[model samples]
Structures are given as structure tokens and as C-alpha cells.
Target chain A: MTAENQSFQPKLSDSPLVVGNHRLSSRLIVGTGRYDTMEQMRASLEQSGSDCVTVAVRRERLYDRNGQNILDFIDLDRYTLLPNTAGCYNAKDAIRAAKLGREILRTLGNPGADWVKLEVLGDSRTLLPDPTETVVACEELVAEGFGVLCYTSDCPVTAQRLKAVGAASVMPAGSPIGSGQGLLNPNNLRIILEYLKEDDPEYPVIVDAGVGTASDVSAAFELGADGVLLNTAIAHARDPIRMSRAMQYAAMAGRDAFLAGRIPRRLYGAASSPSEGVISSRPYGTLGKGDQGNSQSGEG
Target chain B: MVEITVNGQAVNLPRPMTLEEVLKRVDVPPNYLAVEVNAEVIPREEHSSHSIGNGDELEVVTLVGGG
Candidate 1:
């Protein structure tokens, strides 16, 4: 039953996700933040099954000789480092952060030297992106030849606008950053996937934030998202390494399920067993009866 | 001597020196760092020769954890 069936290889069904000038074997992108220690961050990232890791550009802790950098714990040869413009609220400052990130990566000779996770926040409280500033930053980055992965709210029009403005990847948030809400608006995300991947199906549409658990990651992929980028979902977990493993499996299963295609949703239950070969009448006739026909089966 | 701001802290350099000299004097990690002076990025190659100036605001940045 096994020898002759070995003609099919599992690799046949595998497809890599393509971002700006990069091809990734993993659909999940995890961040190197919020872990209590560098070892935990490293372990979580190792379990996350991601080929790319995001880092923020911040002031080099001056005068503290004992300060440790995320770079010391990360392996550039194994993972591509994606630097982000996290704390910037304006296009000008975001642009500055992006440049600083690029310079740092470039100096380190990491492959992510040419790209950025562009985030231009609006209100400090909500941390929602200002669409206007984001657009401006996207154009400027594109002009400067950086592969811009733009993050914005789950607005279909904004997603489309980011794509039109030359964002390498249009990452729409499932909810507010660090909210841990799992896909608050799936319909909006569906519209975004449709709008962004209409003609260019290979265009990467990553669900960027508000992933609470492994199910959230899978839900995003099942919604036909190309990838999911998360941080606090793992970092805030009770056991980050285990959660990271769960997330990895969820990503694979969800993508496979999406590719397998789900059956249509129906209002009524459809019996898996054929009614033609029924051995006996329904025992709980009252269940389907009162709910549908209310017929009494005397043979019960 | 010239006064320059590095990472928002005012520092009085004993003498005007190249960017690398200032980085060495401050004892910051030379790897994975980017220097921005007056909002303009200074490439790595120029750091070894670029001279520090009076009242120049510098921002030295590196990669940290975030998403």
C-alpha cells in the first residue's frame, strides 16, 4: 500500500511567498520584541517558522556598555532582518526612521538592507496609521528604491491605495496594534484581499497586527491572506516558544486548508451518510422534527 | 574644541574629529549603527573621514526589537 504510491512528493504542493526582491519559504513573520530576555526572543523566533524578523530603529543606548543589542542574538545568515519605523507619527520622521533602519541593515550586510516595514502612525493613543502621511512616505520610499511594506488599517480603499502607490506589500491590521483581538473585521479583510490581489494574485497581503493566538494566525491565512506578521501574540504568551510552535503549525494548516478550498456554508445540516443506506429511523426525531418538519417516527 | 549633540545629549568634543573618532570616544558599538547629522544620513564609508562640526545635531541609531 505504500511503495508504489511514493511517486507524489510533498514538495510538489509547496509555494514560496514573494515580497519585494525577496522570496520566503515561511508565511509567518515574527518580531524580535517584548521578550523578557534575548534567549527567549531567540527561542521564540526559532520556533516561529519565519524566515524574516522585524526590528525597530531606536537610539543606540549610549554609555551603557553592558547594553545588549538584538543583533547580537539574531543570526543574519538564517533570517532576513526587516527594520521598522514604529514610533514615528509623521511622514518626515517615519522617513527618517526608515533611512536609519536601512543604513543599519546595510552596514550589517543583511539582505533586508533594501526594504522597510513602513509605519506612519497618527494618534498616539490609537496608534492607527495616518493614511495621508503613509501614502506620502510610501511614494518617497519607493522613489528612493526601498522595498516598502506599508502597514495600515483594515480599510479596503486604503489597502488599494497603498498598492497603487507602490507599496511592495500592503499589510492591513486585523485590529489595533497589541490589542490581541483576532480578526475583528473579516469582511473588511476579505475586501482588502480581493482588491489587492485582483489582477496580481501574487501580491503579498499580510495581516500585520492584533493576532491573539495560533487560531488568529490560521484565521488570517484561511481568509486568503498571503502572510501574517505578528509580535505580541507570541511575546505576551505564557510560554512563547510553545506558542511559536503552535503558530507555525497553524500557518501551515491554514494555508493548506485555504488551498484545499472549503465547502459552501449552508443554513441546514447536510448528512454525510447517504439516506439511501439508512439502517434505522432517526432516534431523536424531535431534534430535526421540531426544527424542520416535526414528524414523529414510530419506528424510533 | 567643538560642541555637538549626539543622541540628544550635548557633548563638548575636546577637538573636532572625524565621525569614527567621535564614535570611538563615545565607546558605542561600531557595528549595526547609522549616523544622521542634521537629518542627513552619513554613509559608512564617509564615517571614517567625515569631520564633526560645532552645533551639529547627530542621531546614532541601531536595530532594536519591535513590530
Candidate 2:
């Protein structure tokens, strides 16, 4: 069904996105990690037109020699920093990191941050999201008044659980993190989108990782994903700014296509047969039952 | 001889050595991150065959897993 069939057509960013009551202008989120250089990172961020960027908090006390906070590189005024528990492998660690982030924000004169990038990895090889731990953490975080942006498996069940637990948005992987695999499971992604639409039509469903190029982002948008969260694709690209712009256009195109409604696919050929006007009557090929069909055995 | 640090280890380099020569003296895994000379970050393409003189404090910030 097209969006026209629905009772309401919400704007892409109309999902009541007030993280910690801070209103965001854009639904697009970008990760501020993995760029080849700071210049490229900044350029990519500017190109993506994202209002929020994800940063990971490390337990170590290491500092760059310049005494500048690594995160300070990004202009905080322009972007809302969403500290992610990227290193956490389970619910407990991720939850603890989120709490620590809130505590750190308090000391920074910043209030408790309600927005968190909840990442609970199942395996490092594929960097797939652990549905079980993710749900556990999301439930806990949602109860704590935190708006969770859960990085989950591209599974309908996981998406349903996140939505049921009041996740601000569900972020399913396009493939694996940093794999540059690019939508390895489009079927599962479409399934998740359908599930979200049926379950909690109001909440936004975003494709988080495994996007290798602009087309990948477009593909996600085409599948009705509200937005996308990507890092490695642009960071590792030969031209980060170009890649970032490409991704931006791709997202727009995908969203536009989804809104416009894609055309249906057909199994049998349509009425326009290329050979309909041509005549060919010179074929003498046959195959026996014992043969492996070296020749056509069907009626013309 | 002037002391230069490579990945936290102090070593002696001649009065003048190109950045490239110093890299050969030290073992660093090529994976991610841009090279830095003193406080200035340098691109990877310039890393090979560049020269660094003695008494030059080079700080190479390698990018690792974050976010």
C-alpha cells in the first residue's frame, strides 16, 4: 500500500524527535568516527546535513597532545552529540556506558542526555547486533526515560520488541558494521520495515550500518526507512565530501521513491514480446528422458 | 645524536632525517589514521619517503575503533 492509503502522512522528521526535550531539525544522524582525517570528517559532516553525530566514550584518560578533546573537533552548537556504547558487547556494559555518558554530561554543564546510540554486538566478525541484549538494554533504557536509538538485527521480531519497548527509533543494520557489504539482507530489511509499519507506524525505522555507497543509502530509503546512520562508507571513501553528498542525495531519492510508490514486478513476460513480429521456423532439437535436457523438450 | 620518540619509544636520529627515513627505523602497522609531524597531522600518501630531522617531536595519532 502507498502512503496515500494511510490515514496520515507524516513528514520524514515528524516522529516527535525530542531527545532530552531538545528539538532536532533533521532526522538524519551521522557517526563522527573512522574518517581518514579531521578535515575530511568535518567536510563529510557538513555534506551529510545531519543535525546529530554519534561519538564513543573511552574509559582511558588519554588525550591528544594538543589538549583538545577529541569530540571538540565537531562544533557542538551545530550538532547534538549522541555518545554511543560502541565498545559494549552486552546489555550491562552498554547501560553502564550510557549512565556514564549522562554523568559526564552533567559535569560538562550539559544536562542528562536522554539520547543514546545503543549498540550491543553479537559477533565481531560480522558486527551483527545481538537482538536479545539489544532488547534488554532498550527496555531498561526506555524505563529510565532515555530515548533509545537501538542498533538491532534486521529482524522483524527485534524491530517489534524495540517498538513495543518505546524505542524512539529502530536502527537495523544494512549488513555488518564496516564490512562495506551494503544491504546484504534487503529482504530482512524490507520485512523489518513492514513490521514496524504494522506495529508502531509512528516511530521511525532507520538503517544504521553496512552502507557502502550512496546507492545503499538510497536502497534503504526506498524500503521506507525514515533515515540512515552511516560512517565507514564516507570515512573510507577516496573523497569523503563527495561520498557524503552522494549519500545525502541517495537518501532523498530513496525516500522520494518510497513516497512515490515503486512499480510492481511481474513474473511472466508482458504483452510486448520482441519476437512477436518475427517468424522463425527452423528448429530440430530433441532430448530424451535419460538425457540432461541438452535440447529444449518443451512445446513452443 | 638527537632523541626522537616513535610510538612512545625514544630513539636517536641523525641531525637531519627525512620523515620517510624515520618511518623505516620504526615499526608501525599500516591500518588506519593520518600521520602527524610534531603537532601537525600529515596524510598517509606523504608518509613514505618523507624526511624528519633530529630533535623533531613527531606525534602520530592512529585512528582506532570508536563510535
Best by TM-score: 1
Each candidate's TM vs. the true structure? Answer: 0.92, 0.66
A206-263: candidate 1 lDDT, tens digit per residue: 9999999999998999999999999999999999999999999999989988988887
lDDT of 2 by residue, A58-81 (tens): 532234443334554677567777
Task: Residues B1-67, candidate 2: write the lDDT tens digits.
Answer: 7777654557787566777666554333332122456644444456665677665666543322255
Clashing pairs in 2: B17-B52, B18-B50, B18-B51, B18-B52, B19-B50, B19-B51, B19-B52, B20-B50
Per-prediction DockQ scores? 0.82, 0.08
Clash count for candidate 1 is 1
Quote the positional error of residue A253 for candidate 2 in Å: 1.4
Q: List the residue pairs that clash in candidate 1.
A: A289-A294
Question: Which candidate's DockQ is highest?
Answer: 1
What are the runs in model 1 whose C-alpha is more than 4 Å off?
A2-12, A60-66, A283-300
